[model samples]
Target: MRVSVILPAKNESEGLGRVLPLLRSVLPEAEIVVVDDGSTDDTAEVAAAAGARVLSSPYSMGNGAAIKRGARAANGELLVFMDADGQHNPADIPLLLARIEAGFDMVVGARGASGQASTGRGLANAFYNRLATWMTGHRVLDLTSGFRVVRADRFREFLHLLPNGFSYPTTSTMAFFRSAYPVAFVSVDVVKRIGNGSHIRPLRDGVRFLLIIFKIATLYSPLKLFAPAGLLFFLVGLGYYGFTYSTMGRFTNMSLLLLSASVIIFLIGLVSEQITALTYTRPDRP
Candidate 1:
């Protein structure tokens, strides 16, 4: 199958200059597409100089948006996505492709502990991986790794589901699992990023980190996350009601509120579960 390597870059001219040549040397036949996310630097020029097809946006659209643009514009049967920064190694591309050839629908280059940019990011990723593993009942070595290879047709199917922000990898991985598509992980080590420092802000993106937890549950199985929460509220409310009835011989408003909240949360989960199921339905199906 023909392969397309896609790199979404923003002010990464230095890294692209290093990565693009390595990519060309490693996979001469594969199509290379570098998406310039409105970089003020010479990112587009550097990519073009390396003989990669360049796609430039007018303004900084977002990492996920650049990915979507590259995916839509690529012309290969297999799409390989890697970081534009120098962290991801081009030599490991073959490993991901091997897994895809082994009948897996997608293959991710799972990063080791040493590959993380920082200890806090590593810890956060560990939590995400555990949560995803529990939600999908699969061993998820890396839930947020950007280095992966997937069938273009299958990946395109979920373009609408991908956010324009930073968590496209999270959304795509969970979507594949929820749809029963085979996904595999191959261990890979990453180096320090080249060019400009990481664009992710600790303060702003930290909030997005929490949202990713909710996104994971809603993407795979909403009930798996919401059910336990509702049960917790129910149990607490029941205990409070028992204590109040024994002491005051009356049902208290606080207990009533908790009980009502339990029921509401559960009903919301039930509805959300149905909605989530519908999202995975094939468009051809009636």
Candidate 2:
């Protein structure tokens, strides 16, 4: 199979210098494409020097935008996406490829304890993994690892839904699960990034990751989220009504409100579940 290796870069000339060489050595037959996301430095030049086809954006779009551009330009049946910051080891490429060859629609590089940049990041990843697992009913080894191999055609289907930011990995991973595609994860150790600093802001990205919870609910199973919430309100209303009737021999407005809200929320969830199913269903082609 023709494979394309896509590296998304932004002011990552130094890291690219080291990463591109290793990729070339390990994946000699693969097409390497480096997307320079409006880097002020010589990132495009560095990638060109390392024999990688360069795709330069006029302005800084985002990491995910770069990925989309590279995917569009690549002429491969399979696509591999990895960081340009040297955190991903090129040697692990073969492992992901092997899993993909074994009939997996997507193969992710599952980061171990040693792979995280910090304790906080590790904890955050753990939370994401658990949330994804709960959402999909399948154990998620990693939720945000950038190193992954995906079938080109399958990956392209959700291009319009992908955000133009750092959370593309999260979006794509959840999407594959919702679509019922075969996915696998292989443990991999990550190295320290070569660059001076990371572009991700913890506070900002943390909030964004939190929003992924809603995406997970909407993507795979909206009822999983809405049902529990409705149930909570329903239970609370019932309890309050019982307590009030026993004490004051009266039905309170608060109890009625809660009960009404619970029913409304549940009905909305049922409608949403149906919509979600229709949205994801592939229409028959003539």
Candidate 3:
């Protein structure tokens, strides 16, 4: 089977020089597509010189935008996405694709780097993943892995759902799992990034990452996210009314506000479910 490997590059021309060659050696028959995400450096030239088909974005769109662009330009049935920062190993491409071939809709590479980040960072991701998995009722082994292989046809449906940021993998995984698609994970070695520095700032990007998780959780199953909240609010409203009436023996306006908000949020969850269902429905489906 032909595989399309999409590398989203931004100011990584020098690094691409090494990554592209390694990929060429490992998966010779696969088509390599590099997306120049508005890089000021010679990323386009270097990618071309490395024998990669380059898709140029005139300006620096976000990482997910580059992925969507590269995927659209790819011609293979299976699409493998890798980071251009040299953290991913081309040698593991086959392992990822093997999982896909074995009948998984998506195959993710789970890096063996548990302490890869700081204690706080690692713990945060672990908690967030568990919470997301619990909310979606799907087993999520890795929520932030960029090294993955996905069916090009099913992967295309997630392009629009992808936010223009570094959390594309997490968002796509949640959506796929929410839709009941099978995802498998392969353990792989994690190498240090080859470039000078990482583009991520743990402090700023960490908050953004948390927000991304919330967005995905809400998008896939709003009720799963809001239902608990709605229940809490409903209970609070009822308690408040009972306490106020028992104390003063009179009805109050504040209880009305709390009850109203509870109903609104619950309605929001119902509306979100309908919209989400309509978004994925197909006439061809039984």
TM-score of decoy 3: 0.94
Between candidates 1 and 3, name the one with more favorable lDDT. Answer: 1
Q: Is candidate 1 or candidate 2 better by TM-score?
A: 1
Which prediction has the highest lDDT against the true structure? 1
Better of 1 and 3 by TM-score: 1
- True-vs-predicted CA distance for residue 45, candidate 2, Å: 0.9
Candidate 2 root-mean-square deviation in Å: 1.5
lDDT of 3 by residue, 14-129 (tens): 78988999999999998999999999989999999988999998898988899999888999999999988788889999998888889999999886545255677667667767
Model 3 scores worst on lDDT over the 10 consecutive residues at 112-121
Tens digit of per-residue lDDT, candidate 1, span 1-286 = 9999999999999999889889998899999999999999999999998899999999999999999999999999999999989899999999999999999999999999999889999999999999999999899999999999999999998999999999999999999998888999999989999978899989989999999999999999999988999999999999999999999999999999999999999999999999999999987843
lDDT of 2 by residue, 186-257 (tens): 999888898768898887788887787787777778899889999999999999999999999999999999
Better of 2 and 3 by TM-score: 2
> TM-score order of candidates, best first?
1, 2, 3
TM per model? 0.99, 0.96, 0.94
